[model samples]
Structure formats: C-alpha cells, structure tokens
Target chain A: MEIFDILLTASFWAAAVRIASPLIFATLGELICERAGVLNLGIEGIMVIGAFSGWMAVYLGAPLWAGVGVAMLAGMLFGLLHATLTVPFGLSQHVVGLGVTLLASAVAYFAYRLSLPEVTSPPKIVPFQPVEIPGLSQIPLIGPAFFNQTPLTYLAFVLIAVVSIVLYRTPLGLALRAAGENPASVEAQGLSVTAIRMGAVIVGSGLMAVGGAFLTMSAFSSFFFEMVNGRGWICIALVVFGAWRPGKAALGALLFAAFDALQVRLQQTPLGALVPYQVFLMVPYILSILALVLMSRRAEVPAALMVPFNKGER
Target chain B: MRLEPIPNPSALRSIGLPAGALVLTVIVASALALLAGANPFATLGLILKGAAGSKFALLETLNRATPLIFTGLAIAVAFRAKLWNIGAEAQLYAGAIVTALLGTGILPLPSALLIPVIALAAMLAGALILLGPVLLKTRLGVDEVVTTLLFNFIMLLFVSYLLEGPMKDPMGMGWPKSPALEKAARLPRIVDGLRLHWGFALALLSAVAVWVIQTRTTLGYEIRAVGLNAEAARFAGIPVGRVMVKTALLSGGLAALAGFSEVAGLKGNLTLDLSPGFGYTGIIVAMLALLNPLGVVVSAIFVAGVFVGADSMSRAAGVPTYIADILMATALLTMVLALKLTRTRIRWR
Candidate 1:
C-alpha cells in the first residue's frame, strides 16, 4: 500500500483531532494569558497537577465531570499563587512561573506517592470515550474527524470560537488587549490593569487545567510522571506562531497535532525501518521554530509583554 | 501594607534578607512536614545527618553538588547579563553525548591530551546548541526564553535516541546507556576510597573564575550595562549584541561542563536519566545565591545537601525523597519574596 494512501484516511484525521484537542485548549489558554501581557510559563506544571488531580478523583469513584472540576480548582489555586507573586508583588514573571511549576508538580507527585504506595502498577481510571454526533457522523471525509470525539475534544473545538469572540468582540477583550499593549493607558482609562491581568490568568489557567484534565480523563487511561511531556511549552510556542490570535493558535495546534499523528503512523510503516522514530517526533518542534522565524517579522507581539507594571510609576 | 521599591538598599539588608529567607523556608517546610505526619524537627535533623553524617556521606553530597555548581555558575553568568538561558539542560546533555563519544577512545591520544580534549569538545558542543537560539534571537528577534526552552526538549530526545540505539551498551544486560569511559577519560578521585572526584575542585575554580571575570573585567562591565538597559548600553558605545552572544557561549560552556562532570566523575557513562533536571535546579541554585558567582558554591552545596539528605530521609523516615524538591522550590519562592521585602519599604495607605 502507498504511504500517502495510509496517511489520507479518516482514522488519521480522527487521531489528529483527538491529539490536537489538548493542544488547542492549552494554546487558547496561553493566548488569553499572553494577551493580558503576562507569560505564564507554569502551564507544564499546572497540567501535571491537573492530570494527577483528575486521575485521583476518577480513581476515588467521582464522576468524570467532578474530576475535571477538581482539576480546574487546582489550576486556579496555582494561578492565584502565581498572580499573588507576579501581579501584586511585581516579582519576576519567569522566576515565579518556573517556581510554581516546580512547586505544583512536586506537591502532586508527593500526594500521588503518599496515597498509593502499594500500587506497583500505575492505577487506572475509566477514561472519556468518543461520542458520535447523529447527522454529522454520517458524512464521508470529515465525518468522524469532526463529529466523533470525546466530550472534552468538542469543548476544545467550541472554545476556539468562544475565545476568539471573547477576545475580539467583548469589552473585556478590548481592556485585555489594551492592558497588554499599554497598561498605563488602560489605567488612565479608569480600569485596573492588575485586576484585569489577574482575571485573565485565573480564567486562562482554568482552561489550561481542563486541557490537562483532558489528558488523564480522555486521552489516556492513567497518570504518569511527566505525562504533560513538554506540551505546555509547545502550546507557549503555538501562541507565538498564531500571533496571539485564538483562531490562528487553534490552527497551529491542529497543524502540530496532524504532524504528531502522522509521526505515530509513520513509525509503523516500512519508512520507520529507514529512519529513527525520534527524528519523526522532532517534526513539530522543528517546524514551530521555522514558523516562528518566518513570522517574527510580522507577528504583532504585545509591546508591554513581560514588563512589570507598577500602577503609579510613570 | 504594600511595598515600594527602594533606590539603594543597604549592605546590611542584603545579608540579613537571605538569612531571613532561609529561616522562613524552614518554617514553611516544617509546617508541610507536620501535615505529612512526620516530625518536622526530626526530619530536619535527619536531613542534616544524611548530608554530613560520615566521610562517605560528605563525599556523596559533594558528588551531587559537582554538577549543580557548574550549572548554577552557568545560569549566574547568563542572568547577570539578563540573558535567560533556559536550555542549560539541553546544553548539558549535548556536552555529555560529545564527551562520551570522545571518552570512549574514539580518538587516539594520550591520557592528558584526551581528557582536556574531551572537556573542550563537550564545551563546544554545548555552546553550539545554544548558539542557534542566540543567533535566532539576534537576527529574527525571537524570544530566547521559548527558543532556548524548546532546544532542551529537542536535545533530550536526541540523547534518548542515541542511548537507545547507537550508544547502547551491548555488553551490559539491556541497559540504554553509552559504554563506560576508559580510565584515562575518567576524572581522578580527590580522596582514596571516596567517590568525590576532581570535578568538585574544577566546579569551585570555575565559580571563582566567573566571579573575577564578572567583577573585574571590561567585558563584564559591558555585559552588566547591557543587562541593565540594552538601549542605554548601545548609546554608550557598548556592543550589546556581542556581549549577549559572549555571555550565552560562556553560559552554555559552563552548563556543558556539568554534563561532562556527571559522566566523567560519577556516572562514567551517558544514561537517559543522567543529570535528572540538574539544569532546571541550577536556576533555583543561582537564584538562591542571588545570581552571584561566588555564592553559587555555597548554594549548590546547600541544595545538594537537601537532595542527598532527603534521599536518606526517605530511607529512614519513610518519606518520599521528592519532599526535598518541595523545600527547594519553597526556598526559592521565599528567597525572592525576602529580597523584595528587604528592598521595599512597607507602607499602609
């Protein structure tokens, strides 16, 4: 069979959408946070915390929705810690973000080990299975890819539109953009820059935690050490690739997920015998770097991003 | 109450703040221990004893510290210039892979020549890994934080590929690691019958070397000016780009040295789990040392002691060793908090 024949299939597209669901959620979350002029590098750690919490909840016989709720709470709590450190205290964003990642992941790991020391194997929980939409599921090419997916995957797709609308059409969106571009100007307009940023981070982190919950509750059956596996960093890159736009970021996530799915499929073919799997795994990262280089000239990064805002200072 | 940044904090305050931060870290850690159903005081005592209980224990602490000091100095040198080299982990791996390739007698050279050659090759490999990010930042205006961080994932996967394939030890029982280094490539032990290697001395020397260069050199002045404000430094005739590149290269080289030390001093072979986030931990070490080169030695040792002690604590107290990681993270957070508190005047309005 031809390699192209194998690649162009409903199953491949379905896998891509499934894999890309988490990336979409993370990218959208990061997009919201960066639009408010704060770079939250703690996404990786937050996701790990979310995954652990969600898995533990399900293991303890809670409903899947409850597991997701607990994960969001965990993310919000960490987000609050980050905001307390960086927003109010004016601590370095990079330092606080990295510190939070370490702290959250450590706490999660400690909790996991302490709770289940005797479980020699990683404990399993019932995961989210795909649900097919009635009419759309019968379509030919894009049917299963778009219509058949886990509930979290559908939410992730819907959020793309939701985030785009919230970021473009709402008063809150205008304030968020202005805060990122010029906090002083926003403050002059009688809005609290810190409050807006804090809100952005909290909401953004909630979404990121949900993305993480998608990993344990939907994508995989159980939690493992470092299962977030640098996806958070990839999402951070995706935000840049998408030029801080929700629609563009979602597309970037899909593109990466497509490559990821292709790589997995490629590893099972005759071509896999010729090339190492690691080379294939590197496709998304290398492509992102190239894309960043190509787009850096035109990408409209928020001018005040990463700069600490002192409300009263000039 | 709120904080207002002071223009010039006093010398006494700088010294006092870190000590205060350490005390605060202990208190928080104790509170956490109490929650974990362990005696906080006993856990603290075990940590101290585990770190320096015996001659071998001290050596083990130093052994763990050897790589951290290198990575800490790596971060200090770069951060002094406000260049965040988050790819130290990748650069360390690069150095390790290169050193392993050279150390396994791929080149025909004398012991003295081969060891130095291995170190140099490792450093060059490490620096080259970071050089791409620096160039991308300078030319395309790419953010170094994300680019440097991405490189880490790439390098890790590359190393994993190597260990699993070409570099796998065939004679060993299915272990995914490179072949052990020859005696000539190994770093000599400092004391007889101890695991401590010459790498510890090298780490100390590098720290002092970094300190002198940072404080006493024209290049150091340029780097500092660039760090403070690149536009201002450029107006003053300093080549900000050149300083950034130089700082990046030195930072990468130092981080790579940490990888070289791990392979030559302790592991003697490149494994998948080599360094175990030593590069990331280096950031905390550098921060705890307030990004001062000289302070890195003390901070690395302290951080290393925490890790080693925690390992022993796990054995004795039935607590997971990762509790040490929590303490380190807490220490870093409190350190930053303390620095801010000390530098700011509190006011209630």
Candidate 2:
C-alpha cells in the first residue's frame, strides 16, 4: 500500500524523468557507436569532460546552450582521438577507450585546478530553468514529469525520436548498420566503412558529452569530481539491455531511472529504518548486472562489433 | 592508408617504438608545463628529484609501487587471457575486507602463520568475488566488462557499510574506518627502522612467480592460446570456459593481494581511501609493460614514481598534480600505437 501510495505521486515520477534524461542521451550515444562497430569505452571520460566544460563555460559567462555546445565539442575531440586509434591504426578498443577516459578526466581536472588556482570549492553557475508546456503540464499523473523540464531534458527526449528515425529511416542509418553487421558488404556498396564508423563515434561521443552536460547544466548546476561516477558505464549496460535499439534503450533508461527513484524514496519509508542506506545505493548497479543477465540472452549484438575493417582483408 | 603485417619485425623493434613513445610523452609533458606557465625543464627536474633524489623519496616510491606490482600482475594475467577483468578494484577491496576480518585480532596464529593465512583468505575472497561474473559470462554470455565495472561501485558501497557498522573502530571518533590490524599480524619491515616493508619483497616474489607461470606452466600456455583465439583453443581440446574460470581465479587472487598488502602492510588498517585508484593505475602499468609479468614490476615502479614525483612537483611548480595522470594516459595511448607499429607497416595510397 505504501509503495502504491508513493508511486502515485507526481514528484516521484518527475524525479524519475529527471534521472532518465542523462541516461537516455548517453545510452543512445553508446548504442550509436556500438552499432557502428566501435565500442566507445571513452564514454565515462567524455561525460566528465562534458560536465566540467559545461559548468565552467556557464560559470565564465557563456549562455547555457553555448555551455552545452562547448561540452559537445570537447567530447568530440576525445572521440576523434578514440576513433583515430581504434579505426585506422587498428589498436585495441578496450585499452584505447580506457586511456581516453583517463586522458579526458585528467584534462578536465587539471584545467579546473589551473583555471581556479586559489579556490577551495568549485564555483556555481546559473543553470537552465525548467520550461513547462501549459496544457500538458495541467494533465494528471504523467503531466509534470514529462511536460516540464529544462531545455536539455527536452532535447534528450527529442533525441530519442531523432536517433530512432536516423537509425531506422535514413540511408545513413543503413550504411551505419552495414558497417557494424558486415563491413565487407558496406565496402561492396562503395561506401567507406571507416568514415561512417568514425563519424558515428564522433557524433555519438558528442551526445554522450551532452548527457554529462545534462548533469551540470540542468540537474546539479555544479561540477564535482567523480560526478559522472559510473553513469556512462550504466548507459553501456542500458544499451545492451535495450538490444542496441534507440527506442528500447531510451525506455530502458527510463525504467532504470524509475527504479533508482523508487530506491531513493524507499529510504524515507519504514523500510529505510530496517536496511542500511548503502544497500539502497547498491540497487542500481546490482540491478544492472541482473538486467544484463536477464537481457543478454535476447540481445543480438552487431557481428562486427569489435572487429576492425581492412578494405582488402578477407 | 592500409596496414600490412611485417614479414618479421626485428627484435629491436619492441624497445625502439615504446622508447619513442616515451619521448613523445615527454614532449606532451613539456607542452602541459608550458600551458601551466611553469618552466618545462624545471618541472621535469622537480618530478625526478621528488621521485628518487633522496633516500626517503625513493622509499616512498617503493612503498607506493608495492600494491601496484600486485594489481599490475593481476591485470596482466587477466588481459593476456582476454577475460577483460576490470573488477580488480572490487576484488582488491574484497581482499581488504577479508584482511580486516582476519587480521583485526581474530586469528590466533603466530606471526609467521598468521600473515600467510590472512593473505590466503584475502585471495580467496577476491577469487570468489570474481567468480560471480565468470559464472555469468560462461553460463549466459553476459559481458564481464560491464558486470565487473558495476561490481566496483557495489563493492565500494558494501565497504562503506562495513566500515560504518561491523568493522567500525571503537577508538576512532565517528570516522568510517575499520579497526587496526594486530601488530603481530602486520607485515614486518624489510629493514630495521626503515619505512619500507616486506610487502615490496612479497610483490617482487609475485612478479617472478607470475613470470614463471606464464612461461613454464601448462595453464599459462592455455591462457595465451585461449586469448589468441578462443574457438581455435577450444577446437584444440582446451576447455575454453575452464581456462577462463582459472584465469579469473588467478587474476582476482593477485589483485586481492594488493588490498591485503595495503591493509596489513602499508596502512596497517583499512580505510575508504586506502587505494588512490591503484587498481585502475595497474592497467596503465600492465599496458606500459606490454603485458609481460616481469616487466610489470619495472612499470609499476615507474608509474608509482611518476605519481609521487608529480605530487611533489605540484607544490614546487604551479602545475596541478593531475598532469601525471594526463602523462600516464598519453603514455598508454602512444605506447599502444607504437606497439602496433612494431609488427605492422602502414602504406598510404
């Protein structure tokens, strides 16, 4: 009864929607990259770059949208590095991805410290305010959560539709799909698999950076160390859970955020008194593993996911 | 551009490329120093001075390298087998938790018997922690990378709970830390009144033992075969799944020793901040070492020295200590590319 009572609250759903925004953007980003046959393990660090750059930009007098753009650009630069190594040089994606994460995170932190030499705490910025759709906001239950949010959150929602369309409806989508599923087939079609895959990674990385920017420019309004904190990894899991489809991945992100929101709310109930808070915090990660086990069986990964393409190779 | 495999690369190719990468990394470092408005050569000198100019600085670098050597070996073993065991951080903490449980006045064995027992228990804990993901990977085809990474977050939360609850130190005033290890259970110092401990000796022994395992053991051959091509290894009558399980156990156990060494040797107690990303740093060490077990020791020392030196340099120069991390990342990327170039020739059309 208490669970039912809590589930009926609009604020809880709003919190869930807010939480899902970042995950949605990041999951779609990773899905795009994996679909193009490169596992951009640099998502974690790209998110860090986004968070720091977005927050710093707004703090330094740039508009909120400009901050998001700066974050995306920074993330794309790292993506270029990841693509250059893994795509043409045929380096190991795993090691290269981890290296990028380290590089991007250190860059953000080093730049932060250098730029703010005497400061003990990071400065705050005025983030994007939530904009409510008048009639939609008046609707019951789902109204406040879905129809009222900062511009970035709305952008995340819009991206889900855009990505699904681009992945399924466009000629570019077909080429991207061919690159991941069978690069040789793509080459036979006279399309360059290298360019398509690299472009996917660069664009996807930009989306991932936007996800991190969502945390700072909309959700938290401040940057902190480890703030990205495995969220990028979680989005990777979400991608698998959704079977690499943008729509399903977005839905998975929403479901994950709902559970996360429920866990936070549960801490205030009678159950919170009985269980350690850490148990609640561990739920999202533990659930990610369980979800992977449950869904991995049904997931059909791209055949050439981690395979490098050489034009003349068999 | 197209890549072609070299007919046979010269033996000197291995050393030359990585050395070139290091030079590039030095250029990157100088570039970073210029950005920070510090003298590049002066900053480099300060790092070297802080790392090994004094006996004390050298001792600190060794102490830092001790845990890294263990974790580096763990990563090297797992990576060579293609297990993608990124949960070394979680496994290390699992080992630390067990060390805390057994070494905090619980075990009644003498100094000689107690230390090994604690270490053994710690390794078992780490092995069992990784066993979950291994089982999942083998049984249901779950990706171990994500699972292992998620486990790190879960393990940290679990440790946080333990430190605040059952393992809380009574003498400490409301701090989240475990009770101190018994003096008899602690690893003895390598010298009289010196900062160095026997953990460094233990780490060196582990590196040598791992090198032997990789070169001289049947298990090592199976791991390499499985890594190179799992289907081929399976077709050759090697149990690919079993090899993976065994590799996980070995890798997880080695990683756990890092936690045991940190708890029972360096810190003498378990705290949340016991590892300053040493598990993650171990990956850099292993890659820098080119996944060679014996080379892990040298790379661990180098990585640890850079970190310690960078911290010292940050105070002297106006540069941030994070420059070392950037340096590490640059080194990893550049070296990996360099390693590839050793065996492959790039031709432009």
Candidate 3:
C-alpha cells in the first residue's frame, strides 16, 4: 500500500483522535493553570494519582464515570497540597510541585500493590467503549473521528470549546488572566489574587485528573505502574507550544496524537519495518523540541508564571 | 498569622528546623504504614535493619547512595547557578548507553584506555544532550523546566530503542539489555565480598571537590552570584549566560557519571530500568541538602537508607516498598516548609 493511501485511512484519524484525547484534556488543564500564573510541575504526579484512583474505583466495581469523579477528587487534594505549599507557605514552586508528584505517584503505586499484589498479568477492567452516534457517525472520516468517540473524548472537545469561551469571553477569566499577569494589580482591585490563583490551580488539576482517569477508564483497560507515562509532561510542553490558549493547546494535542498515530502506522510500513519502532517514538518529542524552538521566540508566557504571589509584600 | 522573613537566617536554626521537620515526617509516614495494616514499629525496625543493621546491608545502602550522590551534586551545581536541569535522567541514560557502547568491543583500544575514553564519551554525550536546553534558555528565553523534562521522555525512548535493537544481549534469554562491560572496565570494589565499589569513593571525592569549587573559587562565586541575582551578576561584569550554560554542562556531566557508576560499579550492563527514577529523586536530595554540595552526601545516604530499608521492610513486613518514596517526599515537603518557617516568625495578632 502507498504511504499516502495508508495516511488517508479513516482508522488513522480515528486512532489519532483517540490517542490525542488524554493530552487534549491535560493540555487544556495545564493551559488554564499556566494562564493563571502557576506552573504546576506536579502534572505527572497528579496524572498518576488520577489514573490510580480511576482504576481503583473501577476495580472496586464502580462505574467508569464514578471512577472519573474519584480521579478528579484525588487531583483536587493534590492540587490543594500544591496551593498550600506554594501559595500560603510561599515555598519554592518547583520543589513543592516535585514533592507532590513524588508523594502522589508513590502513594498510587503503593495502593496498587497493596490492592492487587498477586496478579501475574495486570488486572484489566471494562474500559469505556467508543459510542457510535447513530446519525452523526455515518458521515465519513469526520464522523468516525469526531462523532464516534468515547464520551470522555466528546467531553474533551466540549471542554476545549468551554475553556475557550471561559478564558476569552468571561469576567472570571479576566480575573485569572490579570492575576497571572500582575497579581499585585489584581489585588489592588480588592479581588484576592490568592483565591483566584488557587481556584485556577484546583480547577485545572481536576481537569488534569479527569484526563488521567480517561487513560485508565477509556484509553486503556488496565492500570499499571507509571501508566500515565510522560503524557503529563507532554501536556506541560504543549501548553508552551499552544501559548496558553485552550484551542491552540487542543490543536497541539491533536498534532502530537497524529504523530503518535503515524508512528504506530509507520511500524506496519516497509520503511518502518527496516528500523526499530522506538525510532518512531522519538519523533513526537523531537518534533515538540523543534516546535518549541521555533514558536518560543514569539511565545509570551504569563509574567507571573512560577512566581509565588505574596499577598502583602512587593 | 503572618510570617515575617528573618534578615539573617541562623545556621543553627536552619539545621534544627529541618531536623525537627524530618522527625515529624517520620511520624506521618509511620501513621501511613499503620493505615496499610502493618505495624509501624516493625516496619521501621525492618527499614533500619535493611539499611544498616549488618555490614552487608550497609554496603547495599552505600551502593544505592553512590548514584544519588552523583545526581544530587549534579542538581546542586546547576541550581546554584539557577539553571533547572531536570533532564538529568536523560543525561544519565545517554551516558550509560555511551559507556556501554565503548565497553562492547566496538572500539579497538586497550582496556585501560577504553575505560577513560568511555568516561569521557559519557560525559560528552550527557553534556551534548543538555546543550539544547541551555542554549534555548540563553538564546530564546525558553524555560528549561519543560524542555529538559520533555527531553527526558525522548531520551528514554531512544535508550529503549537502543537496548531492543543495537544493544540487545544475544546470549541472554531475549532481555533488552546491553552486553556486560569487560571485567577490566568495571569499577573495582572498595570492600571484599560486598556490593560497595569505588563509585562510593568517587562520589565522596566529587562532593568535596564540588564544595571546594563552590566556596573557594572565582568560578564558584560567579555561579552563586548568578544564582542569587542574575541581573546583578551581569551588571557586576559576570557573563551570566556563559555561567548558566557552563553550570548546566557540569551538571549534565556529573549526572552522566551517575549512569557510569550504575553501569561500571553496580549493574555492569545497561537496561531500560537501569534507574528507578534516581535522576528525579536527585532533585529531592539536592533540596534536602538546601542546595549545599557537601550536604548532598548526607542527604543522598539518608535517602538511600529510606529506599534500601523500605526494600527489606517490604520483604520482612509484607508492606509495599513505596512507603520509602512516600517518606522521602514527605521529608522534602516538610524540609522546605520548615526552612520557610525558620526564617519567618508567625505573628498571631
């Protein structure tokens, strides 16, 4: 089969959308947090907790949606840890973020081992199957790619649109942006910068946990150690590539997903047959670096990003 | 209550506060162990026994601490210059792959020459990997945190590929690992019949070397100046960018030594799971030391004890070994919080 013929298949697009959904959820979440001037290095840990909690809920016979709820709750608790450390205590953001990640991920692993220590194979759960919208999925490639997706994937798209609307067209979004840009100024308006920033972090973390839940509940059927992998880190990078915009971040997620799909497809081709499949795996990361190099020149980060907002001090 | 920062943070206070925090962290960790249906005292006893109860256990703990010291020092150096080299894991993996390749008979050299050459190659490969992030930050103002982190995933994938394809052990039963290094290229053991090796000595020596460089040299002063305030350092005629890049290179090079130590000192081979997140744990080590090079030695050993002890604890107590990780992370969090509290008085007015 020709390379173009292989690339143009509906299945490829469908796979791309499916693969990209987790990142979509995560990047959108990260974008919101970064836009509010908090760079959460705990994304990896939060994602791990999310994946673990979601898996645990399912393993305990809870429905998939309930698992997602548990994951979000876990993410919020972790986020609160971050906020308490970096905000009120005014400790280093990087250290607190790293600490939370280490703690959360270790706890996740411990819980998993404690719950299921003797499984020879990773215990599997009934993963969310893709919902085929009766009327919409009939439409060709677009339908299968967009309409025929898991409910989580559909939520991810809706989140993109909702986040876009919230960020660009709302007063609360304005407060978040101002808080990120100049917290002192936002505080001058009698709006508590700490509250706004903390809310952004918690909300963002919840979304990120949902993204993590999607991995165990919908994307894959089982939870393994380090199952979230580095998708959280990828989301962190995509936030920069997207320049803090939800739409752009979502698009970046898709671009990465496309690369992921292409790599898997490449493994089937004669060219890929000649090379180790890991070579294809390197493409997305290398591409992200290149993209960052090219785009970062013009990218504008939040002025207060990574800087802890001290309420009364300069 | 409001916190007021102390103008001059006392050394005793700094040390005392974090120590107290560590005690609290242990109490919290013990509570967690209790929640897990294990006797906290038994778990603690197992950890102590596993870590340093016997000579053999002590050697294993030392063996584990060696790599952490290298990576911790690597982090301390870069952090002193305010450069975030979060890609130490990638650098370590790169170095391990390079060191392994040199030992695989690919280079036609004498054993003595091959060992030194492999070390140099590892250092160079690790530095080169970090060169991108350093340059990006200095040139385009891109943040190194995300870039360095992203590179880690990329490098791990690269290492995974190498192990599966070019470096797969042929004689082994389909394990994705490189061929073991020549016996001549392996690090000599410091003690007979123990896993402890020359890497521990090297780690100790490097710590002293870093501490001396950090305190007793013009370059060290420059690095600290740049870290304290880059704008002031630049105004005071220091090349802030060059110092940042140089510090990053050194950090990467030292982190590479960790990979070398693991391969040459312990494993004698390269595998995908060569490091159980030692690179990231190094950050915790550095922070626990307050970014002090010499302090990294104690912190690395302490952290190593937690992990080593946890392993034995799990074996003996039927508790999950990850409690060690939880303990370390808790200590780190409390350490930073305690330090902050030390410098600030709570005003409950």
TM for candidate 2 is 0.99
Whole-model lDDT, model 2: 0.93
lDDT of 2 by residue, A189-301 (tens): 98999999999999999999999999998999788889999999999999999999998989999999999999999999997879999999999998899889999789999
Which residue pairs in candidate 1 collide?
none
Cα-based lDDT at residue A296, candidate 3: 81
Q: Name the better of 1 and 3 by DockQ.
A: 3
Give the winner by DockQ.
2
Per-residue lDDT of A1-314 in model 1, one digit per residue for the tens?
64687567999999999989989988888888889999998888888888899889999999999999999899988988887788778888898889988998998898888888667779889899999999999897699898999999999999999999988999999999998999998989989888999888888888888889899999998988889988888898899989999998999889889888888888888878689888987777787777788788989999888887876777
Docking class of 3: medium
**Candidate 3, position B349, lDDT:** 32
| Superposed model 2: Cα runs more than 4 Å off | B10-13
TM-score of chain B of each: 0.96, 0.98, 0.96
Q: Report the alpha-carbon TM-score of model 1 versus the true structure.
A: 0.97
Candidate 3 residues B103-216, lDDT tens each?
777787876687778888898888888888999999998888878988888889888888888788897689889998988778888878777888899899989999998999
Model 1 residue B68 lDDT score: 96
Q: Rate the local accuracy (lDDT) of all candidates.
A: 0.88, 0.93, 0.87
Report the lDDT tens digits of candidate 1 across residue range B1-349. 3468888989888879888878888997787667778999998889899999988788889999999999999999888888889889999999999988989988888887988899999989888888899888888898888888878888888988998899988986887889999989999988888788988998999999999898999988888899899999999999888898999889999999999999988899999899789999999999999899989999999999999999998888777777888899989988898889778876654
How many angstroms is residue B13 displaced in model 2 relative to the true structure, after the best TM-score fit?
4.4
Q: Give one digit per residue, the lDDT tens place, for model 3 in A178-275.
A: 98899888978888877888888888888888888888999888888778877887888888888888888889889889888888888888888998
By TM-score, the best candidate is 2
TM-score of each: 0.97, 0.99, 0.96
